[model samples]
Target chain A: MGQRLIARRQSLKYLGMLAGSVAGREFLAAWLPKSEKAEPIRPTESSYTPLFFEPEEFSAVEALTELIIPTDQSPGAKQAQVARYIDFLVSAASEYNPALQHEWTDGLQLLDRLSREKYQRSFHEISAREKQMLLEEMSLPEQDSGRTHPGYKFYRLLKEMTVEGFYTSQVGLIQVLEYKGLSALSEFPGCTHPEHQS
Target chain B: MGTHAAYDVIVVGSGAAGGIAAYVLTMKGLKVLCLEAGRMLDPSRDFFTHKFPYEWPYRGEGKPGQYGKLPQGMEWKIKEWTDHLYTIPAEDPYALAPGSKFTWTRLRAVGGRTNLWGRGCDRFGPLDFKPKSLQDGWGEDWPISYEDVEPYYDRVEQLIGVSGSSEEVYNTPSGKHLLPAFNPRCGEVLIRKGAVKLGIKVTPKPLAVLSRIYDNRPPCHYCGACNWGCDVGARYSSLDVLVPKLSRQKNFELRTNAPVHTILMDRSTGKARGVTYIDTRNGLEYEAYGKAVVLAASLVESIRILMNSRDREYPSGLANSSGTMGHYLMEHVAFNSIEGFFPQLAGRPTSNDDGPGESCLYIPRYNYGEKDRKYLRGWRFDFYTGCGMGPGPGARFPGFGSAYKKKIKELYPAAVQMGGYGEGLPFYWNYVEIDPGGLRDRFEIPQVRFHTTSEYDHAFAIRDEMYGQMEEILKASGAEIFPYEKESPYPLGSVTHEAGGCRMGNDSRTSVLDEWNRCHDVKNVLVVDAGCFVSHPEKQITHTIMALAYRASHHLAEEFRRGDV
Candidate 1:
């Protein structure tokens, strides 16, 4: 993945020179799973009723969201109640955009079919390792140019919602991200660092 | 009070120009009736200022299943906030020609676009009025000069309270009564290295935000919600600054939802007698008489009114004998931006970078005096930093997981996007007219067919050249420029700094209005809005719009007092 990223950056002429010189270039870093906030996420329970999804589909969706942005030190999407939020959103918006309901139903149903074909079990019924592997398999075609894979497309859509739901929630924004905005500051302390100036 | 009241002057559209015109005219002891098509906006009630994304019902993307263009970006693909600020497209429809690329966003509030404006207060210099004359002479020049509107500029800055530093620049002149300027941020300070290397100045932007106390209005607390409407009345919105003062004046009266249909003309006198307007709430049309009529109904709307006001006396629309109405349409070329982040600021503790809710740095038009040029007119640079706005920078990053989340946290505060904007040369074919066969809105006013004949091949060439210079500025500052697919200016009419539908010039044969914004064909009619702008300088033009309207209103007042009409 790291080599592919470097090759892709180098392929673009404008990025060719920077790839060799800058050690701070993100592609040079290790592709290992080691990350900050590596502790397990204690996801808060939400008694949210699924609006669009059936009980089985909702459980599978909840699992997928957690896998995409799992809790480490802070709470994850499960704690943010993102799947329920998405289900409610799709159901409410069905009147205006009927295609959305079809997209979600079909996407989740495809996830079930793919899991059953691969492992002879539903997505939620699969092992934790099997779930991650299946998701990564869906994610692989995302980097490929021009080929719009439906499984990869669904993964991208799911990831977008998970990221949006997590980052916008109080658990994601204040608890984890430590956002410091919308405050009345008497004075804005701008660029006092000596190294940053010259 | 009677529904029909006789007025000394009738003003249309209460945004930047109409706001100033109402204040000036009413204060001049004239009974001014300001007609705003939009309903009143309550800042405290309507404004979604300082609101968290999670606080709203659907987390600021509006109600579930509502599909609209995400005001910014592709993903998270809905209104994250300030969606209610704009006029609904279905409610206010306009036509776009077959291949025309124009995205018109209108603010439905009383103050119009100023409620959510960036609050840039850049004053036009002496050379700006003669945009074409000073250069190789390709376009038209303003009927009025910077000298003719200098005192009005001084008056506007005094009333509005712009905070900026004197860089001693030529194009962006310093206002006489400016409040103290804000200190440059880490991103702004870092980018100056590239600007200095390129022999250009990056000065603190002249903004209408009050830095210190002025006119009993409190100074800006730097909450960074200017685009979402300022709730504290710190920034200069027409609702905050102009309407409050206008409310006190006994001669002033604001009639909301009264959209002006046409300028009612008396065939005998050969002058604008009054205007017929529809009261939106009642579905009834009424006539309001005035000694003089001020058409400050924005650039497109004011021109639409004149074009719709056809009669036996003046068939080619009122005051349009030259057939030059709706010609010479102009919009400032903007939206080509480079998303970048300072690698140095990565992994740093997050601090609030929303300094008064707008970019403080400005690379004013330096190529105005230069001999060589990339395109027709020069482009200026300004940056907007959206620090601590949640995972937006991470969208560009490949892959997702705990590592992705960690990377987003590290880079969230380091994000900054700088854009280049330039002067748009007036094209005669690029104009807005009453839609030949378009739907009328609820108010029964005919929709406008917005048209722009710009291929943007020249615009792309300008941006491509600008990218090289802007890239150098970013690269020198150790900022990683994010590669974006958007390589040209935003579709024309997207940048709300849209001006010029009825051009003002010395000759009535080629222009619509005279130097004082009064129509040459009809003496009593005046266009005090940006509709009268002959050409735009290489900067954000709302400040110049306010100054021109103030000067024009004063001229109208003088003319009215002298019984010139």
Candidate 2:
């Protein structure tokens, strides 16, 4: 039985190596940087403070971004370094779009107030499934106040940023979906997939 | 003045054509001074290393009225449309009566629109240049034919590093391509299959974007932020190849933010003496003279400079003896089509992170031959497969809630659509006349009055036929069509692919410049831009424009050597 267990472990290890050789190596090569090269994400911190939200409320926003794009199959919002990006973007809010920054901050506080009234836990502490359910519930056009319910409007902003951040990131592009032709790929099949045929 | 300060040639606009002209001229042992109206922006400092559209000061757009177009929420994308290009405003924005709204987009910074352009480097065949003989009375023939430009085109394809296959039978001229053409992703492959099933000849197009390492430039990183600038020095922009090379030359001096106001002409001789321009930063005026002056400052601005000269010899304008200073403006009439929930995209996470919308395949003009069609001219079609579903004005129409998200996921992958890039006829009515009422920009400079797309009906008919062809492909693909309103605005120069403002011709009476783009009246002044294009060929004009600049400057050097200038 111990020998059988060791053999099983060996098989698993071989499979992992094979998988890594085929796809993981290319992915890791893209993910890992050489010593000479600079990191895609810069080290400078963002100047955009959470305008309407307190420190606690801003944490909820960060958590919410992660929840929407979880770090599972690929680098989610957190791994793609989206929070840093959002911070850099928000700090320069007065210059780009003031209303957008206000809406983002206000939405966080409103969501926290609504959450406190319902389940009694902070948004970040909530279960993943529960958070997803709440998001799904509030994502309605009727719930959007356009101005009054800032949280509802803020949810929309989060959605835009989540999708934008995910799709634009290297992990979301290559890992989630196979996007091979940065420079021409050797053997790209142009719309000839048998399953794709109408 | 001695030949101490001034160079043998003074080239305006450090964009694609101007950069190439400077490189060629400087390489030929002539000193060249290249002036750019915008600031000299470095890519490392100005572009990339930022996130979100709101990270920019102008929100990635240029300063208002800098483009001279009207202000609208939709126009915000005009700024993000290109990093180096400026959005030319439509102060006296002309409409196509009730139905037409055109987008004339331009880049005004260091590299110009080549930074934002799709990099679809298509060639003009013998038919496009000699259109008058091929299909007479529709449009005039190019002053020179494809054969004349063929050698230069081959040379440019080599220097710039064009990648593609040569199906020598098509309208696009075959060449000795530097690299093999890029193949489409799986989604694009599906579209190609559908097109083939529909009898559409869709092939991988020759693109300026590199597939392999060529000309010492790196291959594309596939970052997909192509409409923004390339940070990796992959795409063929002036910054990557031309300007950097030109900067290395001891004879070349490029000064940016100097907006040329007028051409300084010798009153008695009626010759172009120099140019008077305002420094955009300091707002101070400076005059720079040269033995020969080449105007590569686009179609409209190039002509506007000459008109503002207002010399005594030619009262109407400097080179107004032909009475064709600003005539025959043309833009590509892009007819777009969209459909949702493609079957192929179902349950698949596809990578939409590719280069800009420069398509892999092109549906060559089908109605070019002697066929019974309502439209006089033919239009080309290009298709793109996009990923990511957005919740905007079109969000509610598709559906709502979780189903919508699921539908979006399903639809995003399957979403492949085609658009018609139709040709606009060069009519005398659709022209740019100077604003006599003295309408000024935000910089308080006088704005140009462009009256374009007068022949909208003719242009629309051609577009409609192309749309019908798209419908046929969709049907052949067996994709379920989600219907939307076909209410696009008229060809209002929105794309900023502005051409034919100062047309080239053999006859000086009907055109602004001669075959060499030389002002018929002025011996030393040469215009090398869309201003010199008599007809707008089906292909993008940048390559042709650069080639012309090279040819024109080469001619100027030979002339100067022969004591002609």
* Model 1 spans > 4 angstroms off: A1-46, A143-150, B1-5, B64-81, B369-374, B486-488
Candidate 2 Cα outliers beyond 4 Å, as residue runs: A1-198, B1-5, B49-104, B352-357, B370-372, B386-399, B441-444
lDDT tens digits, residue span B422-513, model 2 = 76678776766657667676556565665654346766677666667777787676554444335342454655556886778888888878
Per-residue error for A84 in candidate 1, Å, reads 2.1
lDDT of 2 at B255: 88
TM-score of every model versus the real structure: 0.92, 0.75
Residue lDDT tens for model 1, B1-565: 2333388899998989999998889988999999998899888788877888788777776664464443312112115455666765555677877776665667655888788776888888777788678766778778778789889989999888899987788656887558888877788888886678778888888889988888999988877766677888889988899898989988999999888999988777787878989888898998898878999888788888898898876787889998889877777666546766777887788777767766677788787555556577677888755465566454445455677677777777777667777777788888887788866887778888877744455566667767777778888778877655554566666666677878898899999999989899998888988889888666778888899899989988887788786
Evaluate residue B412 in candidate 1 and report its C-alpha lDDT on the 0 to 100 scale: 72
* Native RMSD of candidate 1 (Å): 5.1
Q: How much of the real interface does each model capture, measured as fnat?
A: 0.42, 0.14
DockQ of candidate 1 is 0.30
